[model samples]
Target: MISFSVDFWYAGIGAALIALSLLAFLLSKRLLKKLLAFNIMGSGVFLMMVGMAQTQNDGAADAVPQALVLTGIVVAVSATALALVVIRRFALASVVAALAAENKAAENDAAENDAAEKNGAERTGSDTAVSDTTVTDTALTDPNLNKNGDPQ
Candidate 1:
């Protein structure tokens, strides 16, 4: 008959957690999900370390592994915070870049319209009003423009 100790259970569970978390992390596309999976994997590592420590010390609590786990928890929390900040910045940058591209396209379109109107007026000797209304209408009707007529 085989005997399963508490230490063995802990190690087994920890290994399973590590494997599942690793898979989740790799398969996740979102930054937040990946971060959560990474944190779970860290927890699994701590559990495995504690289980190994107890096994090595004849089921007695060891100070080294406990201290290491404590330190790791602190570092993990700090790293998570840093990662969140980075993710927020990255999202903001992407939004800004997209808005800039839309604005550039809108500006280019307005310039082309103005140039075309000027050429048509010169050819026919007729004056066309290149007013703000024309530009505003173009901007307002644009799918890329926001409600305020700003390019999104």
Candidate 2:
């Protein structure tokens, strides 16, 4: 007749797990910080529910809570997967957009350099208070060109 009374232990474990889970959810952690913490919280909740079931005089574990935990874990996995997919998509799109902008600038610069080769006078003089490049505000790189087709 030396059976242990697991009621107090089970209750204490359940309370601790619930408190920790809430703390994990309420803390001001960055959204992308890590996913391990969320998984740990889910585990804690599972344990807490299981421990609650154990608090009863029955020494055997129940099946309902275990099944619930399985379902919840599946749902969590789906949500995490979707979130990761979205983050990856956004990161890729940002990189592509930046590359396209750079490519456009390069094309513009090449066209200006070609015009300078064909029309030397428009790019190489400072005889006035404002050369063509300065008059049109070229300042090393220009978005507009003079009638002779050189960047200004």
lDDT of 1: 0.67
Top lDDT prediction, candidate number: 1
lDDT of 1 by residue, 11-125 (tens): 7789999999999988776778998999999999999999988887777888999999999999999999999998786566445444433444455566565444333322222
The digit string of per-residue lDDT tens for model 2 on 1-152 reads 63665744665665676676566555635444345456556666776677677656374677887789789989988978886886566456434433333443455676675554443333433325333533233322232223222311
What are the C-alpha RMSDs, in order, of all predicted structures?
12.3, 16.4
lDDT of each prediction vs. the true structure? Answer: 0.67, 0.54
Pairs clashing within candidate 2: none
Model 1 residue 82 CA deviation (Å) reads 0.7
As a TM-score, model 1 comes out at 0.68
Worst 10 residues of 2 by lDDT: 143-152
